[model samples]
Target: MIQIKDLHKSYHMGANSLHVLKGINFDVKEGELVSIMGSSGSGKSTLLNILGMLDEADEGSYTLDNVPIKNLNEKIAANYRNKFLGFIFQSFNLINYKSALDNVALPLYYQGVNRKERVEKAMHYLDKVGLAPWSHHLPNELSGGQKQRVAIARALASDPKVLLADEPTGALDTKTSHEVMELIQGINDDGKTILIVTHEHDIAKMTKRIVNLKDGVIIDDNFVQQVRATQYV
Candidate 1:
């Protein structure tokens, strides 16, 4: 359901042009769970940002389910992103002032969903993450795992098509990280296309296939054989 062709992106760090991604090409079909593994400065995050439409590539074409993303204007891009993509971060980007419920409802608000319906939908996702009781709790009051669950709830607020995760388990303890991975895997089971970028071997093993990136290019793309699953984060 996703395609990339001759993708190239670079950054200007003063005079030198630091190439991040060069002629990268890949495809992800519906219901496929893909993981990206790379060391630091490998451009996995940059690739994720471009895939999410939060960052523009200097050149190349990106198509998501038949829609060409590179040609869209900011407004159109934002709309498409809001409607189709969900993001999870290592930092658990939850608003401190807002309750878990309110934070999850924020995306729907931007989508012009009515407050009542959005709250209902938000709670539905929160419930899925086993955070229904913590809905009224603030971020500081929750544990790291709970906070991540809240963030995932917010990401699923609009039932997005692609879940783009950047080191999703980075901040949690072992037990908590595993819990979060279970939740993410469950979402993938429900038919959402998932693309995760992880530095951890355990996290990479959870996906059906892993794509290794180095020097902003795909070095190896294949399925791991029966990865030893670890319980907890």
Candidate 2:
């Protein structure tokens, strides 16, 4: 579902350039759950940004669902991001003033989904995330887990080709983190391809495969025995 070969990126500050993602190569098949793990400056975030089409690689090739992702115009990139990728962030990234329902409906709103269908689709996903009863609650009114669930629902509302989560369980307590992972595992079981970027070992173990990055390159990529999040939850 996703492919990357010889990916490279760099950030320039004045005369010096800090190279990131030196020669990354990987592929994610449809319905697979994978985690990208790395320490600080390991380029996991850079890789994620490139995978999400939020940033362009300085070199190499990326193909998402067979569509080349190099040098896309801003308008085309934004459209592809909307149509092909869904994002779940550690911070939840919800608008505090908006109710959970409204927050979930925001993407659909941008997609030009009509009001009636938007409401219907939003409610359906909120319910799917077990947040239907709290749909009217604002982000500030919900717990950390609830807010993240709302974010997940928002990501899922569009049914994108893949879900890219950045430190998805980073901010929550252990139990809550496990609960969120359990939900994520269930989603993957239903055949949604997911790629998560996280620093936590336990969290990475929950995924079917782990790709370890160091100094801008993939050091290891292998499928491990999947650890079900339910055990921890």
Candidate 3:
């Protein structure tokens, strides 16, 4: 469902240029759950940003669902991003004042879904994430795991083709992280194409495949027997 070849990215600071991704190549098929694993400065975030269309690569090709993702105008890029991708960040990026239901409904609002359908869909997702009871609570009113569940519901409300999660379990305690991963695994089992960018070995192991990155390149990519997060949760 997603493909990249010879991807390269760099950033310039003053006279020096820092190359973040060098010759990266990979593909993710539908119904696969993959994790991109790397340490600090390993270019994982750069790769995720490119995949999410939040940033452009300096070189190489990216095709999402067969659509070329290069040199597109901002308007078209945003449209494609909305239509094909859902993003979950390390930081729960919910608005402090918005209730969980409203936050989940926000994306549908942009997609021009009417109020009735938006609320119904938002509630559906919130219930899917086991947060229907907390729908009226604001972010600050929820615990970290609860907030992340709200974020997950928000991401899923649109039913995008692929789910991109960057350090999805990074901010939670071990138990909470395991609980979140269990939820993520359940989502993947239901056939969502999920890609997780994380440094934690245990977290990476939860995925069906692990692609290790080092110094801006993929060092290893292989599928392994999946480890159920419920074991730890």
Candidate 4:
């Protein structure tokens, strides 16, 4: 569902340029659950940003669901982002004052979904994430796990082609992390393509495939026997 070849990115400060991604290449297939692992300065975040279309690569090519992603104007880029990608972040990017239901409906609102259908779709996803009862609660009123679930529901409300999660469980406790991972695993089982950028080993194990990045390049890519997150939860 996603493809990249010879991808490269660099940030310039004054006269020096720090290359973040140097000749990266990988593909993520439909329904595949994959994790990108790396330490600080490993460029996993940069890679994810490029894939998320929040940033662009300085070199190489990216194709998402058969559409080339390069040099598009902001208008078209935003359109593709809405139509083809969903995002979950380390920080649950919810508007604090908005209730969970409203938060989930925000994406649909941007997509021009009418209020009635947005609420219905939002409720459906909130229920899917086990947050239907908490739909009226604000982000601060919910626990970290619940907030993340709300975030996940919001991401899914738009029904994008791919889900990109950046350190999704970073702020949660171990048990809560497992709970979230279990939910994510179930989503993958239902054939939603997911890419998680995580430094946690056990978290990466929960995925069907792992791609290790070091110094802006993929050092290892392999499928593994998936570790069910339920057992840990």
Candidate 5:
């Protein structure tokens, strides 16, 4: 679960001041699948970054599960992110030479998880994403869908509470995108909060709730009574 109130982010471009988020307020409940949709320069990605603590806001407050992210020390925040948050990006962010398993295990390595236990957990997640057979393959060795699956595997390897996916299906074809969404749905079914940022209507429809942002502010918010996913099986 996460909550943001009066959140603001700004950047300086020479003499001009650019505001990315302007006092946005939103709350994501635990085990809910939500989407944030916006067009170019709408600050959806900036909001995601701020929510995930990768970027700081100039004003307002953020709380994850009950702890205030801005109130924590840098080291403590890093530890909390490692322990509770999973991030899926448009770029996949895989290491070029590392095998799928190795890349998925990278976060665990940073947390000092022992090799055997870390690798075992990584492989478990890889299999969950249907990439068990590709565990030894490198990023370049996999196709678009396969690469995304590996990325999802990496995100789940840590058993994170919430998954922040920014344009998660951006790099794949329609079929592959559905496949990835189904996998994410499965994750949500297992009780992980999922916040997806996308511009695609179909992608937004798959979620339980949708929030539209423009000019760094939420313009509309809708919650679907019935949850719809790309796949149930």
Candidate 6:
């Protein structure tokens, strides 16, 4: 479902250039759950940004669902991003004033879904995430796990082909983190291609495959027996 080959990225600050990703190569199949694991400065974030089409690579190729992602105009890139990918961030990224239902509805709003269908789809996903009863609560009114659940619902509301999560369980307590991972695992079970960028070993273990990055390159990529998040939850 996703492919990258010889990917390279760099940032220039004054006379010096910081190389973020070097010769990265990987592929994610349609029903796989994978984690990109790395320490700070190991280029996981750069890789995620490139995969999400939030940033462009300085070199190499990326193809998402067989569509080549290179040199596209901003309009087309944004359109592909919206049509094929969904994102979950550690920060949740919800508007402070928007209620959980409205927050989940925001993506559909951008896609020009009408009010009735937007609310219907939003509520459906919120209920899927077990947050239907709290739909009227704002981000400030919910716990960290609840807020993340809302974010997950928002990410899924559009039914995108790929789900990209950055440090999805970073801010929560262990139990809550496990709970969130369980939810993610459930989503992957239903055949959603999911990629998680996280540094935590336990978190990476929750995924079916772990790709370890170091010094801007993939050092190891291995599929393991998936650990059940419910055991920890």
Tens digit per residue, CA lDDT, model 5, 66-145: 98888667888789899889999889999999999999999999889999999999999998888889899989999988
lDDT at 34, model 4: 98
Off by over 4 Å in 2: none
Model 1 error, position 80 (Å): 1.2
Find the number of clashing residue pairs for candidate 3: 0
RMSD of model 1 against the true structure: 1.5
Tens digits of per-residue lDDT for model 2, 61-179:
99999999988998999999999999999999999999999999998998999999999999999999999999999998999999999999999999999999999999999999999
Model 5 error, position 203 (Å): 0.7
lDDT of 2: 0.95
- Tell how far residue 80 is off in model 2, in angstroms: 0.6
Model 4, C-alpha of 172: deviation from truth (Å): 0.3
Instruction: Compare candidates 1 and 2 on lDDT and give the better one.
Output: 2
TM-score for each predicted model, relative to the true structure? 0.95, 0.99, 0.98, 0.99, 0.94, 0.98
List lDDT for all candidates, in order.
0.89, 0.95, 0.94, 0.96, 0.88, 0.95
Winner on TM-score (3 vs 5): 3
Q: How accurate is candidate 3 locally (lDDT)?
A: 0.94
Q: Give me the candidate number with maximum lDDT.
A: 4
* Residues 1-233 of candidate 3: C-alpha lDDT, one tens digit per residue: 99999999999999999999999999999999999998999999999999999999999999999989999889988889889999898899999999999999998998999999999999999999999999999999999999999999998999999999999999999999999999999999999999999989999999999999999999999999999998996
Give the 10-residue window scoring lowest on summed lDDT in candidate 2: 224-233
Candidate 6 clash pair list: none
Candidate number that wins on TM-score, 1 or 2: 2
- Sort by lDDT, best first: what order? 4, 2, 6, 3, 1, 5
Candidate 3 deviant stretches above 4 angstroms: none
> What TM-score does candidate 6 reach?
0.98
Tens-digit lDDT track for model 6 on 103-198?
Answer: 999989889999999999999999999999999998999999999999999999999999999999999999999999999999999999999999
